[model samples]
Target: MQLEPDDSQSDRPVPSLAAPEFAAGDRVRMNALGRSRHPRYGERQAVVVRKVAANGWRVLFEGRTSLLTIHRDYLEKVEPV
Candidate 1:
């Protein structure tokens, strides 16, 4: 999904938070915090293999590759590394 800046305020750019820091080859667990029709597998744990775009991160989970291109605001840092 393309992230378009809000048109209500043309003078100001779309405010965005800093992206979370997760390197490739890092293990991560993603939780479903919102409603969507993407998949019904619930929360999942996966390994970060590569980053596709500025806001898109590709993960390898259960021998399958899934693309999670989420906004930076929705992600939270986890411990237990």
Candidate 2:
């Protein structure tokens, strides 16, 4: 049997904190302070590509792979190694 989702609770997305602005090529690290964090991508340094939302910025991490949209609060500026 399949279970149905609860309709009583609101399915609206919770709003996150506003993110700081970053220019292209700014190095940053993902802070482990929020929800939905992956161990493989844990607190890794990334480069800011652009802003996707008021509190979300599109970043390209060190792996030189896919881009991720992370909230500003979860990102901190980091210096190059």
Candidate 3:
């Protein structure tokens, strides 16, 4: 089943406390804060930032090999090893 877009969330800015702006080659990890559709829900992953919009970010996950639009709350920045 496809989920419909919620108009109330359109063009909303991400809270500063939740997530920071990421560059093209930034490393990030998914937080285990809630149930996620991702297979690696709480694992570290490399991502290339396609774009950052007021609503959220468009990113490509290297590990999962999927491009996804995710909310800032679902991501957390991690330093590259």
Rank candidates by lDDT, best first. 2, 3, 1
Q: Candidate 2: minimum summed lDDT over ten consecutive residues — where?
A: 11-20
TM-score of each: 0.51, 0.63, 0.57
**Which pairs of residues have clashing backbones in candidate 1?**
none
Measured by TM-score, the strongest candidate is: 2
CA lDDT, candidate 2, residue 74:
71
Q: Candidate 3 lDDT, tens digit per residue, 12-60?
A: 5435564566767777766654126455555756575765676466677
lDDT of 2 at 10: 62
Ranking by TM-score: 2, 3, 1
Q: lDDT at 67 for candidate 1?
A: 61
lDDT tens string, model 2, 40-63?
A: 767668899988867788999897
For each candidate in the order shown, give its overall lDDT on alpha carbons: 0.53, 0.74, 0.64
**What lDDT tens digits, residue by residue, belong to model 1 across residues 1-81?**
999876878643233555466777776655443113225433555666676667656666555555655433333334665
* The best candidate in terms of lDDT: 2
Q: Model 3 segments beyond 4 Å from truth?
A: 1-18, 34-40
Supply the TM-score for candidate 2. 0.63
TM-score quality measure for candidate 3:
0.57
